[model samples]
Target: MKLKSGCFLQHLHLLLKYTACMSVRNAAALMEHFQLLDVHRKNYLNDLQFYCFLCYVTDLNKDKIMLLFDLLDRNVRGRICFNEFYTVVYTLLSHENDLEKQFIPRHAGRAFQLLDVDRDNMIDFNEFEAKRFLFNIQKEVKKIFKDIGISGDEQLNYREFKIFAVFCIDKQQKEEGDHE
Candidate 1:
């Protein structure tokens, strides 16, 4: 549940995008929905309410929803505030959307931009290894470099990085499918 700096920024970017797309009326409606879900009038949702809300909004099963709820409930207080609810829901929605698009080149470009901290237009092993968690890649960095760096220059330009990103996402999705 602990996100690295780059992953945190990505989630923040997603939340900002979600907020940008939300109309005032839609925001109000969401607030009202949150209020309704706060049956105890505590201005927060317990596990049951969160589970129901996730079930209504997403296709995830009971167990997964509960697990998501647990993750979102950062304080272990058995409740999640409206901000936590909003952030986590939008982040989940954004991730699902990204998956649907199969993480295209544009997405890879943005990811590369984030990882290339020096604006060098290339990613060295350190940069790639630092941000590897964002792509859910647990493989050894050197092995991945050998596999995807077709140019064998020991650095990844956008094209090579795109291939690496796609490879990681494909592997992550396959692993998720296996769990399912």
Candidate 2:
């Protein structure tokens, strides 16, 4: 699905605000406390409700819920723990600006640096999948970044990163359009 730049910006802003008030551990506990897992037991999280929960927590538009799910579990894992949740949220917030209208390369760079814990200038699959850094704000931030599609590929130069950012923004806009 695709979304409009304006809608994407709006959703991004909402997500940032949501993250500001929530911690990763708190968010995780909330999910458990709400019995969201039982709600999804039939589909085992292969349904839209799971995404809706994420959108509900992150304050994202309902339309972008699926995108969040895709980012959170690319491998279609049935569940996401606090660590994984934090990683997703942190990645997103780190890339957004005050206005939430632009994607800062510097922020992305910083996020990449953090993700590359070994300082080897490369993020292995394990690093990409690691949920050890889960924090509430961090989880929402990472989710935002995942929605923007920031894979751990060294081949993404500055130019490529810019293109990817644009692509993501455009995709979000298109998705919003479809919903409208």
lDDT: worst 10-residue window of model 2: 131-140
lDDT of 1: 0.62
Candidate 2 lDDT over residue span 75-134, tens digit each: 557555444444444444433433122433434564455445555665443554453232
User: Residue 62 lDDT in model 2?
Assistant: 54
lDDT string for model 1 (1-180, tens) is: 222333322333232432333445545666787898898999999998887766655556776566556555645799988877765544444464454124334356556665676678888888777555344466645777777877777788889988877676677667778999
Question: What is the C-alpha local distance difference test score of each model?
Answer: 0.62, 0.44
lDDT of 2: 0.44
TM-scores of the candidates in the order shown: 0.46, 0.32
lDDT for residue 126 in candidate 2, whole number 0-100: 54
